[model samples]
Target: MLSICLIFFYILLIISLTLFYFSMFFMFNDLVLFIEWDLVSLNSSSLVMTILLDWMSLLFMSFVLFISCMVILYSDEYMYGDLYMNRFIMLVLMFVLSMMLLIISPNLISILLGWDGLGLVSYCLVIYYQNVKSYNAGMLTALSNRIGDVALLMAIAWMLNYGSWNYVFYLESMKGHFEMQFISWMIVLAAMTKSAQIPFSSWLPAAMAAPTPVSALVHSSTLVTAGVYLLIRFNNLFINTNLSKLLLLFSVLTMFMAGLGANFEYDLKKIIALSTLSQLGLMMSILSLGYPNLAFFHLLTHALFKALLFMCAGSIIHNMKNNQDIRGMGAITLSMPLTTSCMNVANLALCGMPFLAGFYSKDLILEMISLDFLNILIYFLYFLSTGLTVCYTFRLIYFSMSGLSNSMSLNSISDEYYIMLKGMMGLLFLAIMGGSMLSWLIMVTPMMICLPFYMKMMALLVSIIGGYMGYEIFKYKLSWELFLLKNYFLSNFIGSMWFMPYLSTVGMNYYILNMSYKIIKTIDQGWNEYFGGQSIFYYSKNISLLNQMIQNNDLKVHFYLFVIFIILILMLMLI
Candidate 1:
């Protein structure tokens, strides 16, 4: 069974690679294939099943498939003895298919089909552990994503006014059309939920309860990026609108909040999840700034390193006896040298080290931000978030890999999982070289960034300072007293994601849950009791007694009832 799964992934990987190359060619030639099958048609209106084969969709599909192939390969070793391995593999394949459906469809209705598929499959995968924590996480994830699904449904309904559901044909003309702005708002709101921005942000970190492979595919490319991709497709429509500005605000805040939260986070997977959130905010902010192309570039580059990062984290966690706290893991490089090496590469790439996969796209994005005519506050937040990203990356590195040993003196920890290593090695190569290759391919004309020397060096400067701060901040992890005494409240505020999980979960639900409770008490247990079940029971009992009397030939009682009925009829007739 494992061999069959591996073979299946390998074939898909090869086909995806071929498609990617073909997409590059098609993109260079400015080619597109739009195939539409009309499912329903009326006077001047049509509902169609549309497949849009273009460079963007095909390229993204390639990345998703490649990462999925790698993740499944890694999972064989990570999930080796799990009884439900087959079920796990099937769920992942379904996720990939849904993502593909989302990628190629230009019709909103079909997009919703793909969108709902992602939500349902993700919930299943999140609860794969079948524990209380997993169940809660899965519900949070599903309900959060369902918001986006609803938005899509609304968008579909609104698009009915246009007499077509194919958004590809309408995105440009819809610009400046005030009446259609509702659809734009709906799309942005939907994207925000899927990407986990602001109030929706809590679910991303909470979703870490899922297995690491699911996290790798979800946080990296498929589930979370779905919204960003949708925005990219519709970017032209929302440009310069109030919706765009609002999106910019929320996205920047999300970036800052996630970066700050990662610094104080100890759970390895959650830290990485927060990092994914921060990166997502960056992509969204860029898209909001009307540079969907740059956002797409960062998206592709980010998928590679982020997926690699998760895989390495999974390998480390596995060797640590499933312990995920970085404090319990120190000097991991001494034993699992290869895995840690890959992790370090991923971290540096995330920090935007020059010539790495992240540097090409990230450096360009920072430079582009400097060139844009944004306010000082936006500028400050962007740089601050960049620094915090480095801070958390280093903090994670210090406690987990380079710091002193904190585990048991005698424990088995080594990079002996050859299958897992094989998977990491594939992504390690891409995380190193993908950025430059993608830059060469994606940008036909070189983006000449002109900025002063200091401004150009801002990203590097912030990263250096952030790395130093990361080491200093967490230097005394073993000493709880000093750390807690100095900055408990401050750290707690920032570390808890600014209490977003509370606001989104308990805060939002408190009123609604209370109302539901009142409804149950007043209806289900109150009015319903009298008018529903008990009334029926009483009437049925009396009717049965009457029938029994009639069957027993109770002549006196029957005579009295008949005389009363006849007298009533005669009195009515006389009146």
Candidate 2:
């Protein structure tokens, strides 16, 4: 019965989303309208106008909704008997709603609200188990997100105060606000945090405690992409700023760091988590090159393939009876052919194999990097990260599906699981073809197109080499340097970040409570000395007796004086 209801709900959501986009198609000009609530007479037309509608939002929204719908369906079977399935579905609905709102928001405020809403929902889903570890991951996510939220809030406040609350106001007011460099930097900080950029990126790997569907949605399609979306939405603001260059540097660093981490991680989920971060870095680097459209395109393709990959991971874990250790299983490809096939497609997409979705988009990004002469370091980092991505992808595929393990018994993958796996694989296959179709229609026609065919070919060759290298290297003993670096440095760094709130909150609470206790004790001692042991009744009696004695003495004095006065008066009269 619950499964039927969930399906119906998803159908309704899809209908509504389809209607929303179709409406946009007819009233496309309305999208440019920047209505100002504060103004009555000053140019009642749209505050901002741009005919930027294309395959970007359309493609992204299509895949996002499609994957979301599939995930909902898959969860029906995966989470069938779970007690919290209803609650999970509700959160998923809210997450989808927030992402849609984000996609259509015309102004910064709307986008920020959507961003925060998605963050909150994702955190809730991450800790859905309500276990200590899950709660810890949720708290860590919240803390890191709060840092980003603060930066965004500051930027919003600055914009409203100095620039504009509406689109026209922003455009009109931006000319004189070159001095708002601080706000720009703040915006970058916020973007870095949202996109899981360095130093602030530790929360993502920890967030793997979430259910895989949550991982698929939050890590791949929606939550992390919010950062890249922000940068794209405000491309005008960042066009000529030094912040753009800073973004490039930050992105390259994030790519290298996250890729290296992914290379070392043995846990399937953590490897995916780190890869998501690295891919986000790639998107950021593309955005920094002033290619918002290209970045959006890449984001769409990444969303499709990454979500599929995570779902495939989820299916594998489910078939394995929740055993997530990659080393525990091998040579199960024949048993779980559906999962094996889907994973292979996703890995190809991830490794940027030729004709794959990742190939087209990632190739473009690298081409842009090379053409811009930005920095050789950026190019090296990009290539190195690509290689690491390949290594980890193959590592996951090989360990999870290939090789031989004598101790493990193969379980037949269920029909329901196969359907889900196939569904995801089909989507990836479509995404793999989408890039070429879009490029032919959108890129090849424009003489202004700057993408180099040679670079694209080179990237494909590198990806192929990287994949083979990854397969070859998997047989060797694990690198000791990687072990020490990951277990001692990277893991500890991420783990410590996760542990910070506990230590800080507990320590702060202890100090506060201790100080309050000392104050209470001092007050208690003072009260005891002043009033607790004193004889109040005795003091009151003493005061009453003193008052009575004074009154009686006054009366006696008056009577004696009156008598003496009367006698003296009588004697005077006689005389």
- Local distance difference test scores for all models: 0.91, 0.72
RMSD of each: 6.0, 8.5
Top-scoring candidate (lDDT): 1
Scanning candidate 2 in windows of ten residues, the lowest lDDT window is 46-55
lDDT of 2 at 321: 81
Q: lDDT score, residue 20, model 1?
A: 95
Candidate 1, poorest ten consecutive residues by summed lDDT: 476-485
Q: Judging by TM-score against the true structure, name the best candidate.
A: 1
Q: What's the TM-score of every candidate structure? A: 0.89, 0.77
Please provide, for model 2 over 350-383, each residue's C-alpha lDDT reduced to its tens digit, 9 standing for 90 to 100: 8887788787788777776667766668888888
Candidate 1 per-residue lDDT over residues 235-327, each given as its tens digit: 988888788889999999999999999987889999999999999999999999999999999999999999999999999889989999888
What candidate 2 gets wrong by more than 4 Å, as runs, is: 1-59, 162-164, 168-176, 410-419, 440-457, 478-575
